[model samples]
Target: MVIESLWFLIVGALMILMAIGRKFVERLPMTGAMVYLVVGFLLGPACAGLLTIDLQCDVALLRTLTEAGLIVSLFAIGMYLRIDLSNPLWRLTLRLAGPAMLITIGALFVAAYWGLGLAAGPALLLASVLAPTDPVLANELRVEEAGDDEPLRFALSSEGGLNDGAASPMVYIALALCGVHTLGSSNPWTFALAIAWGLASAAIIGWALGTGIVVLVTKLRTHYDHALGLEGFLALGLVALAYGATLIVDGYAFIAVFIAGVALRRQEMKATGEKPPNEVLESVERGQREEAAKDPELAHAYIAENMMGFSVEMERFVELGLMVIVGSVVSAHWQELLHWSVIWPVLFLFFVARPLGSSLSLVGSSMDRHQRALSGWLGLRGVSAFYYLLFSLEKAGSATVANLLPVIVAAIVLSVFLHGSSATILLDRYLSKR
Candidate 1:
């Protein structure tokens, strides 16, 4: 059809413009996520005339794209993180991942229950789905390099990175509740197994597979220096291996991918076969720097960089595709905002739920007031939350969640504007003064 060709042209052109102008956007107040979102908004037909998605037909494909986006983003986030187990910052990350995430979940449950007047199943589902910040959208809020130790950025990124899997248990819980409410069929094992064995399997598989690859790559490059270039794509293999193995057992693949990334990154740090950088600097000859270039440790860094580049490119491609579709969906449902219940949830999610939950998690931490506030303020939700919604809808196999979908979409639209617009200006200004 003529419309399909025009649609492809517009989408392709938009991606091209984003590619060329990436530098410009990076330096400005808006982000690449924002560009895709805004363009989607433009392309979205308010009257549902131009591009109405047939959810029944396209759901599988759409879900795959979003899942891919999350997969790539999670790996990238894990790769960039410096996994110092001994560091207090790691303590902070754990605290945030555990207590902070729970606090957000509980708080949002209240908002959904009282604010939306939903029963247990949908209320808990909304809370669980929306509680965690999305890594795909929170990339700008995260660290890009290995050595950078900015506290808020690290905390937010780690929280986003871990919480996707962290929230999976709750997703199972919510689904169980949905079963109880809808089918009057109660099974405690679903939630119990998902929380317990699922997490354990992800950790085990991810650690085993990821560390295995890193060790193999290190051995190969150490024995055969001429083969360094061959290891560039090893991270992809690690991701696929760990994720596939985890999912095969019904373990959390999202968590597995992230853990694999961390495992591999940790191997890189330790694989140097030399002194730590600080120690190396003291006794090293300035002229020997060239000699050190061939070291296996340096090779690890190079391999990690190439792997990160591949993941980032993949993440961006999936993100652009999904957001364009999201923009169209939001555009078609723009009038859904006229409902008071919809507006209520949007306001609560951004202003009340995220900040309150985030603050609750930071209760005893040494972070000062300003740092604490930024941590609360920067819970940017995107892609994965929508995926959760679609997943719940499909799993329930009914229209009970139909009404809730629009409200969640409305909240996401608000998030796209609220978080996207503020991420750059607010973060830049705040970090600049620091």
Candidate 2:
């Protein structure tokens, strides 16, 4: 534990450096994730023998930590998102994210079952596990909340936001097929609960809670401000409560958290009692916008900004810790990555599966050749994939999952290195040039 604390201090310093000097860090091809991951590898028994973790033994703890990280990060993604869904581009996001994601899953399913010769259950698990793109790397990718967004960035960010939640149904379906859950022909009600109601319930509750909190805060601003300077911090409590409460009832907490962020902004607009409803909310945080005016609304906006700020800082740290832990988790098998089983699955998923689904989904849409290409190319997968696979592994405990772990880890490593390094460079090269 002392060794762990020391390592945290070292990584903590680096995180601070990365936070303040992102401009400097951005100039290098080396990403902060790469740095933290390397640190994790070195501290791990694979090298220095300072940190050791057994994946099979510690799966539950890892699952809880990773899931918590994914949830709050999802909330941050939702908080900053200011997409104009009425716009064709946002609707195009629905096409690219929803249908395109499913197509990717189907292609992967065939690859796993036919090419890799896995059983139906394992194949389904493999497909759904890798289906969602991540917004955890959003800041590095220059992913931002909705407002004056170009089609490509907006498409990727929005896709990352919704698809994380959308992928839950596929995971449940996979679980059912894996015989972990009780849903094969024998349980229709359970099927509806897992596939349909979970996601819908999260959305409704998220929307209601988000709207209700903002309205209540607006109504009792005097009581809120004087009694609690933490109206902003209150959001953290609310988000945590939202997540826990939703999950207790088996709702999709990820979607609920994200939707709550959006709902918060929407409620803010309505608290004024005259929203054009069509006009997008100001994307550059409300508190910062009203800082100069000192209006009655500033207090509310101020609290919201604090919430947003806290979420962002927390999300970054959580992502960093998870990557480090992941690096160490695979340390035991470090030298055995030469085989086809691991290589083939990752190779097909990244180069073949993702691109095929993404490109085909964008055909004849409003976007031009370049936007479609960039969107397809930037299907950056991360936390959401790991979260589902870990949860599934614990739930099913299939022997097939043992085979799946190395490939999943390898794919994520490949993605973090290639995609993280390229996020800024590619954006500048293609989008800037355009």
What tens-digit string does per-residue lDDT give for candidate 2 at 45-79? 88977778777788899899998888778777776
Model 1 global lDDT (CA atoms, 0 to 1):
0.75
Report lDDT (Cα) of residue 269, candidate 2: 45
Per-residue CA lDDT of model 1 for 234-275, tens digit only, reads 656777788889989888889999988888778767864333
TM-score, predicted candidate 2 vs. hidden true structure: 0.89
User: What are the runs in model 1 whose C-alpha is more than 4 Å off?
Assistant: 1-5, 45-50, 180-190, 224-233, 273-297
Window of ten residues with lowest summed lDDT in model 2? 272-281
> Which lDDT value does model 2 have at 339?
77
TM-score to true structure, per model: 0.89, 0.89
User: How accurate locally is residue 417 in candidate 2, as Cα lDDT from 0 to 100?
Assistant: 84
Runs of candidate 2 exceeding 4 Å displacement: 1-5, 182-185, 188-190, 222-224, 270-294
